[model samples]
Target: MNRRQMTFIILVNALVSLLIVLLVTWIVELRRPDPEELAALYTPAPAVLLAPTVTVPVETLPVVGGDAQATPDTGTTQAEGDETVYVVQAGDSLLGVAARFGVTIDDLVQTNNLANPDFVFSGQRLIIPATGQTASPNATTQPAAPGEPQIVAVESAGNLADEAVLIVNESDNPASLAGWRLEREGGPTYTFGNVQLFAGSSIRVYSTSGEDNTIALYWGQLDPVWRAGAVVRLLDGDGVEMMRQVIP
Candidate 1:
């Protein structure tokens, strides 16, 4: 119980207390979570995979009639053997089609068996008859002889209101046009009613709906009956072709 003995006892107690505090701090550090391991557990993963991009090319169609240039407003034409085939385009009339191929309207109607000669739709195939070829079995009319009434000229402006055909009587006597027929090839026909043409006198036939007179006769047509290159025929009362003139 002396002073030296008491000092030694206090030193031994302090050493034991210090050893216990170090052991507690070491145990707490081992139980705490690591920063790298906690970040890996909370990170998000992707939901879907990305797809690859692709491209495709378009195709084009070839033109008809081989290398023939397309005509403006008019359709294209192709030759097959000795015949010419014309494909109808948009805004094509039967009169215009006949004129373009230099064929008569009756030739078109008889060759194609057209139920309605005034109606021709787009993309329709038309077989053009050759020049001087007969249309039907009953088309036996011949051209007019000399010293008869002749179709002198055709003034066609591509409109029904302004289209006209001129006929002149070159004989010495006055000829009667009564019961005479003015035919538009395969289209409607205009018959004269009690009309007379004097010697060396001329008359005009219009292709429009109007009152008829001595000099000018109207065909009463809704559309134009004449076009460029169309054939205009003048027939007698017996269905004989008196004159044939092509529109310019």
Candidate 2:
């Protein structure tokens, strides 16, 4: 072949090689991910978590507003079918008084905000916070007058709706009882709002009128809110039992 023809062929090959290299470089640049797009794909996002429910014991809760004085018995009677029932008697323990109304011990303590707890006396009136009942307090209280009812009683006559309900027999003469609802169950006595009942905490129970004379006194559980069926150490608040059920 002539030298000129060979040179022409070589030149054509060199140009083709250059074009191929440029095409490959362009394809590589296009295939790389954009920095902005990469950031959007890998950016971190915020997360959210749910809070557990909590129930504040009446005693532990701080008083916000209203009459800070002890709940008073205005020398009035709790007539039949009244929304708030009254228990008139001097020197009655919270548990004993509540039993007559088929309530739980914690209900009375929480409703009344008994500070000493061991020291409730006559003429001290209490507000029944809730029928289902959640409980009380540790502030200073003045001494009571002589012959005043020890505890102003309230009632908790209802079914045990899986909520540690107080079962009362408006006239039944004997009944049994347990203290402290499971925290998860959230009984009215230990649960003020929607908080869960805590385990291993002190709780009280009341008997049904005419239905709970078994011990003739109050019974307390030092720590049993974890599970309802388990029995725990018991004590008498002033007196934690029922002497007899009286019709109101």
Candidate 3:
């Protein structure tokens, strides 16, 4: 071959080899993905922790989770602010009378001291104690007029500061405060769900089973209530109040 022809041949051969190399590289790239690729884009986030819920420690379960409570009854029947007294009339059995009024037998007996359930005489005025709302056997002193029911005030107080309030019963009524509720207002009437009383409250005797039982109540810093002229009444089962004392 001539020199010029040989040179031309070498250049053509180099160009062809370069093209072949590129084509092979492209073919090798056309492959299926690997089965085990690491997950890099979407990593999971950690879970967050929260504080436990605060509940009232009373006889019944704490029912104040966003529940609108206007009045405070430690397990009394008196609706928000209603109270009354009933007289034991003729033809009244303890069970029959209690059932008619929608109150427990124990509550009726506690309100009215019946030494002998069978021995109650006619026309003996007795306290019928308060409940949510139900019929009565002729109640006396309705709230505003002759037909309206009386409104009784129930005061509940608790401490934001951790401290136990000593309880004393005025009427000696048997009360269990395993599931109760309390609210406290601080810095602009803010209410907080609470467990027990703050520091001090008026303790009185509870009239339970013909006996006087005392209980501890924690309202708040006792001094603030006493200064505010608040009143707390310890009532009997018959709705007859045993004692009414200014918070002191």
**Relative to the unseen true structure, what is the C-alpha lDDT of residue 58 in candidate 3, on a scale of 0 to 100?**
72
Alpha-carbon error at 10 in model 2, in Å? Answer: 99
Task: Report the lDDT of model 2 for residue 33.
Answer: 99
Query: Rank by lDDT, descending?
Result: 1, 2, 3
Q: State in Å the error of residue 116, model 1.
A: 44
User: For model 2, how does the per-residue alpha-carbon lDDT over 119-160 read when each residue is reduced to its tens digit?
Assistant: 665666655543543211111212122321122222232322
Clashing pairs in 1: 106-186
Please list the C-alpha lDDT of all candidates, in the order they appear: 0.72, 0.40, 0.39
lDDT of 3 by residue, 116-225 (tens): 75455555555666752222324321222222111122222222332221232112233322333221112211111222222221232111122222332334342222
Each candidate's TM vs. the true structure? 0.41, 0.25, 0.21
Weakest lDDT window of 10 consecutive positions for candidate 3: 183-192
Better of 1 and 3 by lDDT: 1
Q: Give the TM-score of candidate 2.
A: 0.25
